[model samples]
Target chain A: MSSVSDRMLTSDPVVEVENLVAHYGSHKVLDGVNLTVNAGEIHIIMGGSGSGKSTLLRHLLGLRRVTSGRIRLLGHELDGVHRSELQELRKQIGVSFQGGALLSSMTVGENVTLPLREHTRLDESTMAIMARMKLEVVNLGGFEHFMPAQLSGGMIKRAALARAIVMDPKLLFFDEPSAGLDPVVSAELDELILRLREAMHMSIVVVTHELESAFRIADRMTVLDCGKILISDTADKVRNSANSRVQDLLNRRPRVEELDADAYLARLTGE
Target chain B: MPIWMHGSWMMAETRLGRVEQLGKRTLGLIAEVGYLAALLTESLYWIFAGVFQRQPVRVSSVFAEMMRTGVSAIPIVFLLSFSIGVMLAIQGIHTLRTFGAESQVVIGIALSISREFGPLITGIVVAGRTGSALAARIGTMVVSEEIDALRVMGIQPVRYLVSPVLLAMLVMLPALTIMADFAGLLGGAVYSAMDLGISYAAYADRVISVLKTGDIWQGLIKSAVFATVITLIGVANGFSVTGGAEGVGRATTRSVVLAISGIVIADMVFTWFLNR
Candidate 1:
């Protein structure tokens, strides 16, 4: 293992997970994972499908039960927090889901102001103004009255981002920010991510499979493979890291297929 | 193995699997109903306070929803109730003519509409329309994580979403039943005047003699209970949904069936208790 770099790491970790383990039925999706996301940094967890990156994000959000280990958000243990407390915690952290998770019943304006209405005593007019401000921040100004179904995929994602940041959360999490976007749109979203980081000075934890996106926006990245971290380093270092798994994932070269088709077919046909 | 023998074995296995699935689903549904009963007890406390407390109820919102439920439902309800009423009148006339008691057909139509047919038919129609719509809406919200969004927003999904529908259904079902009752009576009156060659006044007189306060109140009570059953079943099915569009469709169908059955059963229980 390579030694940890001195300058690449942050001293203040805002979110910390130790010996994290999670399971679904008998399948252990996350096995003894440890990671930290600090304030004013973008920590990207990159992995192939079924590599437990999303599972780990869900644990951080308290959306899933941690089979074992502790998740601390801003020095508070997330486990056993009351539902109301969890909601309060969630209000301070913005999470944009892989799919734009806008409520279909609500218009863009209503969706953005939901958090404000819930957490603040602001009157409806002020809340609406705040909602419009956030919408404009995400470059979706004046599209407030459109339904989620009516918006295009890119616009819906922006609306969701606007909703996520409506409260100016200290920590922002994105699950696959570029999973379904075209390259141009994805790059534009990357710019938005960078702009948000600069403007708010908030920590962002992005779980994504798109290597281009990971390299573009990530301050530091962790690559998960087979329920373990293969490598963790800055964007430049992770790209150059010779870990075969990371290299294969980053380079996008197909691995050799290992199945012996002839033998398998002979056994089935019995000829 | 012979193909027919293998096919028979597969059929048996499939049937046994289906039986097992049905058994599992039935048990799951019972457990869900029990859990929902507990939730509903708490929700009922909140709903009553919200509706009748010092704070005013959103009468405008409730009335708006009632208009949606009642107005859209009228054409279908009227069509069903009128046809049934006409058929019942024509059949009663044919049968009562045998005994030379043709005038008694007016009394039959009035008695059925006032005591049973009006509420029952209206309940079934609303169950199909409103109950299914409510279930589909809730199930869609569940699948889309909209209900979770509401919860995260510190709004109780039960109070914000379910309560509005329940109140609307409760208030409107009775109103719809009254309209259906009038339409059914009108259908009978039309047949009596046009086809039976009986004067409208004679038919109206017979209906007035048979109609009583108790008859109308019983129908109204049945409508209220039916509305409660329909709304509750819709909400329950919506909350139980698991997957996406397929789950919404399944919940809607299940809601309609459960609401209709619950209405029929409640009607039976009410009549039994009231008679005793």
Candidate 2:
């Protein structure tokens, strides 16, 4: 496992995005977004709903193609990477989706061990031991055999986290880790994430709207608004930034943009 | 331009737009067909690759799907095929009796069931039953991001999800069709003995004499094609689902409709080719 740490300690950027643009059909969801995540650091991407943070995360993961931009993960540019190369690159990264996304047909233990089974020729016993170790790391040691449907919301998140990190990936991504959890459970998850980063020595990129969790776990935070990055700095610097959009987001203020009556009428009339 | 002329110009432009939309939809349908064919080719490649690489097909998943798509469908297929057989016999009797050839009813029923009705009915039933289920299952997985999750885990969804089900359908649909054929013959026998004043032995002999092994083989071949069409359409529709629950519902409906239509069209082509 120290080999994983050794690999993770490289000075190269774990994730790099430059001038990234993305679209859902004709409408742009990410406009000229740029980000960089360094080794062994927890980078929090924070934004309100529809702020393109998730879209950015998807692009970083190579799950979505960029309309125009560069995404370099672990020194490999993703723009024109072949399918096999992209898959090989993805093997070094792990993503925990917002909904857990564990296969309902498989038990939690099976879900956690799926990557090992697919990518490694390890014996079943070894895979089981590794899966149990990860579950223990996430405080789900004894509940590995439980079905995902039987788990509580907090437990499901923990199980998903265990599955994500079972391969000891160099770069880990979390999508709203604290969503749908109580305050106490959310805090516990935050602690688990921090501990995982320290123990595994991996770079982490978290997409979240939870301000408290963001501030608590982020080594550096990037705030995005309406498809553009407002600020990318240390937590305190981001909180203290002069940008009105950053301040509004941090203070939970409703954004008020004056509507144009003529535009509104034209939209209603399908013009 | 004058106001009246401008209105007419707008109307003409709208008609042109509608035509363009229709053309785009036609092209989209063709693209979808091409995509599905590519997916099928890729799935076959993976299956063979797995075999050569010693990564055997997931036996447990294939067996589970076999039970779901094939074994569990027996009762409904039986009922449907039996009813069709009985109806064909009754109608054949009525038509033949007018010409003093009511005994030919057995030949008509046997030929129709073995060469056409059995596979077609089995396909339609399985399309409604297993095809919709496949679409909904995969659609829900898509909606919940599980497919993306699998991709993130370095597991190709086509290999893990579609291949086993495809293999299962290939194995099972023909098996179900055979069962349907037998049930249909039995139903025809029952109808003939009870009402048509025909003996069971006479009816069986007539069926055996009039029906060739080639007829059964053709029907089985058609079932295999129907199986591929049903599962491919189902999985393709599932993968294409967007939004959420509503998307899953729409995918399920589309899978069933598309599978049934594809099966019938395929049946027509197979019948023509096999008979010729």
Candidate 3:
């Protein structure tokens, strides 16, 4: 396996997020998050449930509006880009959702070829060949004829990955890639992520809560807590951090805070 | 003020709040309708742009939707229209007999079925069946993040998802109405012969004489408009879905209700205009 130094050849950052703030109605989810992903590196955004990692991912993908912040993807600022330009920008990015998000009505092959069919003027034969090649890359070879419903959880994830990379995007995003998969399958997916970086030279940003997967695959990682980033550095630096919250996360220890009884009662009763 | 007086004052304030809430809800409903109109306009823009730009229409998906929305609906539409036709004939017979104008029963059934019930009943059936299904399917897709996936692929959801279904509805609704009209007329003829002792030839002659081509055209036109309303409402609700599975269910129910109501209102407008 190539070291992080070898893959981080270019200093150009494919993704630059600065002081990003986001909200869900009245509730704030991401609070001043700053992140950068260098070209050809795998950057993992790891946090517990409701830690705003998913919200950050949504903002990065331009699926959600940022409350206050700047997000630059492939050198284009997403904050005020026109709709047509944003769409054109999206063609250079790929995302694999947590649930795979493959169209249930389409076969795996059809799903993979959808982007090409919509955007390219390639003949049907060329499109089919390209789709088959992507399926093979994700270890989903010969599964093209099957519907998404027929695939297992792991296969579904792989199929979604295949579709995401079918266009060979400059930047790729994965939301919980190894989630709900067995350890063996998860490890295989880790290997696939590494190979994709090596083969495609594409920057990858993955949002996950799986520490093992994060440690294994991330060239760099960010740890988010309560919608704020506690650490964003090399994986080794994050693992060796002296912060109690970071340690608690690394050691699988629950955060236990001492509470005042009166305050707790007041909060519960909205007094 | 005394404690009792304060309590009464609080109750009055609560009642005032309720009235204010009602007004707010009414305004919210009007806003939603305005938003839906905007969505319809955007969808129409994409549809026309696709046509003029020679974009590839997904023929297979449109055909599949046609099967689901039009073909699968045949049995229920036929059965319902047949029953309605029989009931109309029976009622017409009893009422006309009282006035010694029983022979006009055939004309009454023919005119009403062709000009009104044929399209209205077809629209209602489709709203309950295909419109609800469209909303549920797309709402589920939204909750599952499939819509986001499409966006990441640089494919517009309106073009990829809504357009094909819209095209299918446009083509199929009118066809279904024509089938329904024929089936209803057939049912009326059978009832006239068996229940009223009127010969089939006499009933057919009366229907042919009373039913103008203009009436059939009016029903077809009404159905076409209803098709647009049903599909636009369904796709709009689907896109607006939030939460999860429960949200999908709510959106589906709302689509059906709004589609049926919109169809009825559109029918009235079309009837008045077309007749005038």
Candidate 4:
């Protein structure tokens, strides 16, 4: 029943993205983006489709190359670092993909314990117990033998969350956690996200477009529009910002622009 | 400009454009070859290092691949080789009847099945089955973001995905070839008894006399080469797949075609060298 401020202690910055720019071919996807996530913080990134929030997350995860600028994760520079060192850095981080990317060939329990199996030589019994514990935390206990296809959308998301946190990663990145869920399930996921942060003391960065979920769980939030950050501030401040685009995003208003007759005629004529 | 001059200019321009297109294609081909070589080298390097570094050879994955590639393919390889053996016997009967050397059918079926058709038929069957399946499976994984998920988890995708299949193919292709060789010889023996009044004992005796140990070794060795090419092409096509489901489909088709072509080319080289 503690307030967010009472329970959260975010003093150390674990992720530092400085003027990060990225491109897909010649098309710029992330335009000089900067972000910081301190330890034990739950940072939400909000954007509509094609806003480049997902691209920025990919760059942060080092899945995509940076066009310019730098990113440091857990104090290791991402640019030009040796691959082995980057892999070592990656062991401390986890990502929950948008589609719940569980290996379809493996059972949920196997999926949850896969990271441990690959990286640790722990006893089979120990790994099983650890996987069950994480599954239980996600309210998916006793569903370990089920294939991922057997799970509902919400269950799949929860199972993915279980796998992401099974390794007790210091940093967690979740993409579109609530994209396909009902409001109730989304709320439950929001509750779980907050609980996970409080219990695990992990820094989390979530890229989502769901305003309700973002406002509910974000410790601090950033809103992105057209590959540019419209605002980055605490929940209360970001919600209250006077930026029109930010307001439009939160209020679900379509952007209105004055009509250009020449451009309209040109478009219509296929010129 | 004069009409004749313009005609000549257009023709000259078309020829120049064709040459430029050819150059571009050649460059693209070279780049693709380089990429494939790099992927193969990387996978082999990981396997080599993992073995020497005391890493366990992911027995379960390799075993699973072996079941899929080698075991599941048994029925088709056996059936096809048996059919080929029967046809070859019938043809041998007709051709050798002219010289009253129909007994030579024993040598033709035994030596050819052991040294050529056995590995060739097995290679084609595996190229159709395991090659396409591996490409489609890996390509779909790529499309579904499972591969990226693995990368994000700090696992080496090449080691986790490619190395197991490589080991499985290396072991299984030769095993299937040996199985096919026996199945084909059995078919020929069965036909020789019924059609040519040759007893199974006589057929076995002739096969034992003429089918040298070196002949069997040659087919097995050629099949091992087939395994390397099929796996490399399938995995390379898989890792290169782009877009979505359509991309996976394209990769699967390409894997089969290229693998079959690679097998034939490699087999021809082996045949030539052996004959020389």
Can you list each candidate's DockQ? Answer: 0.28, 0.67, 0.77, 0.66
Which residue pairs in model 3 clash with each other?
none
Two-chain complex of model 2, DockQ on C-alpha atoms against the true structure: 0.67
Q: Which of 2 and 3 is ahead in DockQ?
A: 3
Taking the tens digit of each residue's C-alpha lDDT, what string does model 3 give over A198-224?
899888999999999999998889999
TM-score, predicted candidate 2 vs. hidden true structure? 0.94
Residue runs of model 2 more than 4 Å from their true location after superposition: A1-10, A258-271, B52-56, B196-199
lDDT of 4 by residue, B1-276 (tens): 999999999999999999999999999889978977887787787778876543445889999999999999999999999988888898888899999998899899998999999999999999999899889988988887889888988787888988888889889999999999989998898888889889999899889999888999999999988998888889889888999999999999999999999999999999999979
Question: Candidate 1 lDDT, tens digit per residue, B81-136?
Answer: 89878988899899999999987889899988877889999999999998998899
Count clashes in each candidate, considering only residues at least 3 apart in sequence or on different chains: 0, 0, 0, 0
Model 1 docking category: acceptable
- Write candidate 2's Cα lDDT for B91-122 as tens digits: 98899999999878888899899999999999
Please rank every candidate by DockQ, starting with the best. 3, 2, 4, 1
Candidate 2 fraction of reference contacts recovered: 0.74
> For residues A1-271, what per-residue lDDT tens digits would candidate 1 score against the true structure?
0122233254567888899999999999999998877677888999998889978887887768899999998677899987557767777888786667787877999989977865677999999999999998889999999999999878888888898899999888887888888999889998999899879878888999998888888888899987888887677888899787788888887656576999879889998
Residue-wise C-alpha lDDT for candidate 4, range A59-157, written one tens digit per residue: 888888898999999999999989778878888998999999888889999999998888788999999999999999999999999999899999988
Q: Which stretches of candidate 1 lie over 4 Å from their true place?
A: A1-13, A66-69, A74-78, A231-237, A240-242, A253-271, B1-23, B35-64, B151-155, B195-209, B239-244
lDDT for model 3: 0.90
Off by over 4 Å in 3: A1-10, B51-56, B195-202, B269-276
